[model samples]
Target: MMPTPGFPPSTLNTEGTPIWITDLAAGDPNHILHVVRGIEPAEALEVLGAKQSLIQACELPDSTPDERTSLPAAALGIEPGTSAALLAGRIGEWTFVYDDSGFTYDDAATKALSADGRMAATSVYTINGDASLTYAVDGEQVQWVNIDDLVLEADLPSMPAELRAAFEAAGTIELEGFESGEADRQIAMRAACSLASLALTLSVLRRVPLLVVPLG
Candidate 1:
């Protein structure tokens, strides 16, 4: 599958669906600009609309690949079997999203995600969607909200073991607590900032242990 710039190599892993979402899926008009550039949650909403509720009805898997395509729309025409393989990984609570579209895999993989109750959304949809696919501050569901710092910190490691440890040891992890007020509104934005910082830090850590890099 074709890859997009500025995405993690894991995005290419057909078995590991991308986890970094954008604001294009279900956010309000004002927040539409935040969606990650590639994943097309908003576009899917345009095509699926209220039908999105169907995602909750499926039997999703635990994990999925995280690719780097431009938008969900990019994967719309991919093969079904590839989609199926990709979706098969997203069966349970351990599902994934991408910075771009899920085009590397086949259509069946995408369908499998829908079939298993897993969800897909761009950063925009996660942040701006009327309903967010991410977890709320108190673990509630907010279609367009961002995940709390605590949630991101807690979840990042679990997203992938080797990757998580690598990041942690590298001291590149940057998940700060939510602001005192307006937690939801700032979650996505904060995550974006923290992630960007983490990326830069990780680059250095990957080479050598900085003071922040743990010995674990």
Candidate 2:
């Protein structure tokens, strides 16, 4: 299928490499459609300065889709609700490549790119078998506004000591996923999703500039 129209053409990076996208399934029965997406594998390795051997991808159990039209608004704690946006593309094998959540080869538009000459989004993700959802995106257009000061004011329990120190040092922490019981699971999922979305956005900016719009 063709990419959703109206989104600008993804931009290419300085090296003339066209960024691509791929997605990994989160593997929950009801939320099995949750995916980690962004640029293709090869480019991801190069950008992250890591090799492919580092990535570990996994598969999910086969099952029927859910019948519910509307899941609880507080089911996952995110608003507007979610409905299997991406399907499980690859089957079997669990591999991790730079463990990036941004873009990959299985995405819709990757087919449009020809051979090694062009770039496409490549996804290396797996099913966590949990109801909680997580994702990340990278793009130059997106802005990483610092809400730490505000979040700190909320005084939501102190992050882990090590993690807390890191956040304090950076004055801001990149999106992260932490398995801190049920209470923090939702927050972690949001962090993961934010990172995934931001990374994909950045990848889009680097490769398909025309389609991406950077946040000031």
Candidate 3:
């Protein structure tokens, strides 16, 4: 997706959606922009007035050929299977997932993370017209955000990892296990979304190292 006037260009991934979000999270220009939850930008602006909006690319490496990981976005040298819609991101000292498509690969997302990673947040879009968001702060589900209503303003309470499995449980879905053929792409898409959601949720909660199921 193209960046707006003030927004910086970052990796935007798409499994099969029109509205694309950048990887980075940006703060308000004056740092007073209220976090927006499940609301349309126009609606938010209408109600909130002309507040500065900031968006940043998530530092997590994107394997997507369009987003650019080790090389430029235009570079054709990206590794196979890395050029997908899922990736990881960082928030303060905490590390979490920021995926576009539902499914993710643990090996790719967590390779740069520490051994004992803390759970942050994950975003998923379901076939049922649901923009589901799961937020695990300090290793627990504090809130569930719908896409339009997602406005994170609360300071994340910091804590140390008691277990080393959090990092191991993130972004490990297999997309190929889902729908096959052009006819099944829609079915596979929903399956991918579900798989992505679970993989992200588990990782942040510090649960058993889960796996993500996705297409190659």
Per-prediction CA RMSD (Å): 16.4, 17.3, 18.6
lDDT of 1 by residue, 61-156 (tens): 222333322222222323322331111112122222332222222232233223323333222322132312232111222233233333435555
* Tens-digit lDDT track of model 2 for 1-216: 111111223422221111222112122212212222333534333333333443223222222133222121112222222322221221112111322222332333223221233222222223342222212223211112122222543433444342233223222222235221212212222233222332233322223211110000
> Candidate 1, residue 60: CA error in Å?
35
In order, the Cα lDDT scores of the candidates are 0.26, 0.25, 0.26
Better-scoring candidate (TM-score), 1 or 2: 1
The local distance difference test score of model 2 is 0.25
- Model 3 weakest 10-residue run by lDDT: 25-34
TM-scores, one per candidate: 0.22, 0.21, 0.27
lDDT of 3: 0.26
lDDT, residue 204, candidate 2: 27
Candidate 3 lDDT, tens digit per residue, 106-187? 2222221211333333344443444443434333454443434422222112212321122122212224543322211122
